[model samples]
Target: MTQTCLVTGGAGFIGCAISDALTAAFDTVVAVDNLHPQIHKTGARPAALNERVELIVADVTEPGTWDEVLAKHRPDTVIHLAAETGTGQSLTEATRHAQVNVVGTTRMLDALAARGIVPQRIVLSSSRAVYGEGEWLDAQGKGHYPGQRSAQMLEQGQWDFPGLRSQPFRCAHTKPAPTSVYGATKLAQEHILSAWCLAFGTGLNILRLQNVYGPGQSLTNPYTGIVSLFARMAKAGKSIPLYEDGHMLRDFVFIDDVAAAIVAAATSDKSGILADIGTGDSLSIAQLASVIGDIYQAPPPHVTGQFRNGDVRHAACDVSATRDTLGWTPQVDAATGARRLCEWIDQRPEQLERL
Candidate 1:
């Protein structure tokens, strides 16, 4: 029997990439996306997307659409990538985030069970934000999960955590301490999938993606996509804003690497595999701006003392588990990946107008 795979958010950045990869591996591929206005103002598919894959414009929150699609196609595998993303904005907009991420995931799982369509595997697109403050090493080399940064401390320009001020520390194993509503919602999705998989004996692969950036990232999303945001700000010759002295670190994985891992998870016999998908490298925000700026000749970002509430100080992961589980390792470095992103943006200069 030919294998079929269904991917939600297929028109978006990671989704489109995954859809293309799935097409190469599977005999049948179906993509479903509502084309949210925030990511796609025109509500149209990108010309660069693979033409061989089938597409359906539908919301995951809507049962009517999913029920029909699931019953009709009966995909052998399912990759769930449709959800709201924006940690800082999610702090202020709890209801919208919860509805799209948490509720929508539940609805998708519920629809599958209702239709008796147990896929061979379910690959969930999770985020590193679930780690919240993440793990930090102290002066004595003891790791600690720091609490929330106080507003008063931020006002005083105290960017570094108290223990982590003097020495450098690397991230350890992820212990979820979601600081923002967005993080909490992503954590909820993991729980939901775990419960559903356990109850039904379904194969589940949870991918905790860390700061993915590439050609098709949303340029309009104000709260996330720092790479795209920098490109837009650079094109307009506007000074980029760097929050919290620009020393905050992130593991920015290229979109292609992420897509490959997603396909691997769907096809490989990797059940009960929960891993962090990243390059296991930490790049500070200041360095990120400089890298992107060189590509577009964008002015240097101004380090603003301002800070967003519920933002994590640093995010990186131990990707050794991901390597063992999926036989996947990151191939693109941050500098090389940033250049590819800028080249793509130049081809579609109109994307800058998205902001």
Candidate 2:
């Protein structure tokens, strides 16, 4: 029996990496992607995509596209990674984010339902944005999920949530209170899939991923993934800009570890399970700039004091449950991952040409 796993958005950074991991487990792997021009500048198949994977160029938002694809290849597992990302971009392009992240997910579920196709499991690549300010700890060490920061507070250079000292934990226990449009749509994806899977008796696994960065990340996107952005600036002989006093915290998980987590979810027998995927640690944004500067031999990062609306103050997810359930652990640390990323970036100077 030939086992097949279909991955949406399977040609991009994380998708391509996930496709590579999936090929070793599933006999056949099919990738469905729109090949968005923002990521795939030529609107063609990415060279980084694994040669063994089959690529279907189509948007997930289109019902007909799903109908045809589902009828042809009923995969044993569906890993949904096709969605618009970025906190700053989502604020201005709310409809685009909602259409792709929320509507696209529902469209795929509707197609599966129409075809009476229930895959062995469906793995959703969710985001930590769903937790908003996430799980913060006050002076007394009491956990609290803060609301969206006001523009006045941001303009006053107030970065973190007042009286809070910590970030969110695992997704299974935290209640989602998304602050950005991107986060709202992601939470919507989880709800839609949960309802569908419940009615269909299909297994569902959701991984609320934190900041993921590595080799294939889009250096030109200009909207998300600050690691790639900072790397591009450093390559261009420019100083990295540190926003919000350079003290904002984030958990930068390596791409390989994230791919492994997704693969674990796809292969696991868990149903209605939610887990957070990250390094289980946190670092200040200024610290991230120092790492990039050291690797690129660029100028020191400057404290810009600029801030973006809809951006969370801190984001670090605990992966204890993920480790226990999926039997996965992060192998690469931030420093080592940055070194490896720079090596890969050096080989592709064309990516830095526009910088």
Against the true structure, whose TM-score is highest? Answer: 2
lDDT of 2: 0.87
The digit string of per-residue lDDT tens for model 1 on 135-219 reads: 6778788877776677787788877787663212222344777888998998999899989988887889988898899987777
Candidate 2 clashing pairs, residues 3+ apart or interchain: 135-168
Q: Output the TM-score of candidate 2.
A: 0.97
Query: On a 0 to 100 scale, what is the lDDT of residue 158 in model 1?
Result: 79
Off by over 4 Å in 1: 165-172, 353-355
Cα displacement (angstroms), candidate 1, residue 348, comes to 1.6
Error of 1 at 77 (Å): 0.7
